[model samples]
Target: MDASDTIVNEIEKALKQLIVICNKYSLSGSLSTVNDLDNAFPSNLPRSTEVEFLYKNYNPEKLKIETGFTPIKIHSVSELSKAKMVMSAY
Candidate 1:
């Protein structure tokens, strides 16, 4: 087994574990979006424009370390709801 093969195996194992976790939580569906890069485990999130719910499980420190990427600004779902309510009031 080469380094690339080992990495692939690790990724596949991680994916299987993730699948089990998702199944346990009943989290399988188009409701989520999973973005993968370079065979790493994917970053999963709900596929909704609503900001409040979008960042439900987002952890900046963990994500940064895991993906080697800086976290982007994410609007909270509560903020989006308030904005909508304000707009409707007008």
Candidate 2:
């Protein structure tokens, strides 16, 4: 319904995938419940004002000039897993 909702769902999906991989490989970890996260980080406040400002004022060209590295363009949280797969293959 919204960007926040999409991000939350994507994060949960990633956690579930991690759980499956951990179970298969006998690794140790656990997925926190949505309620747990909500309790820890209430939605009433902004998550990170600094990150928000950076996102709003992001400049790829400036970054490239300063760092000499071209950043990969990623539009959403759901695209991260796909991007990771591609990078690993590369």
Candidate 3:
């Protein structure tokens, strides 16, 4: 893969690791899907619709951590959808 692809791959790997860690800790936060990641930070194509869906579904106030790379939070479906919409727009 090219440099860009490699970076994307690395980011995916890191996200997976974060998810695993969250699961292990029994964290009440949900991890973003690959589609969500694309929308939140599109590489080439336009952002995916999934980002808005997530924002609308999840809540942001319950967030315990947000490192740009990873966000951990306790969110409802509605809040997630809203977050997705807000993030996708930018």
Best by TM-score: 3
Cα lDDT tens digits for candidate 2, 1-90: 878667756665764665576567654333232223224332344445332322233211111111247632422222334545677797
TM-score, prediction 2: 0.36
- What ranking of all candidate models by lDDT puts the best one first? 3, 2, 1
Off-target runs (Cα >4 Å) in candidate 2 are 32-90
By TM-score, the better pick of 2 and 3 is 3
Candidate 2, residue 71: lDDT: 36
Q: What is the C-alpha lDDT profile of model 1 across 10-53, one tens digit per residue?
A: 65566456556645755423123323311222223224322222
Separately for all candidates shown, the number of backbone clashes (residues 3 or more apart, or on different chains) is 4, 0, 21
Writing each residue's lDDT as its tens digit, candidate 3 over 1-90 gives: 676666656655765676677667766556543334434433443333443444333323343555578765555433555656777999
Q: Provide the overall lDDT of each model, using Cα atoms, as 2-decimal numbers.
A: 0.38, 0.40, 0.50
- What C-alpha lDDT, on a 0 to 100 scale, does residue 88 get in candidate 3? 91
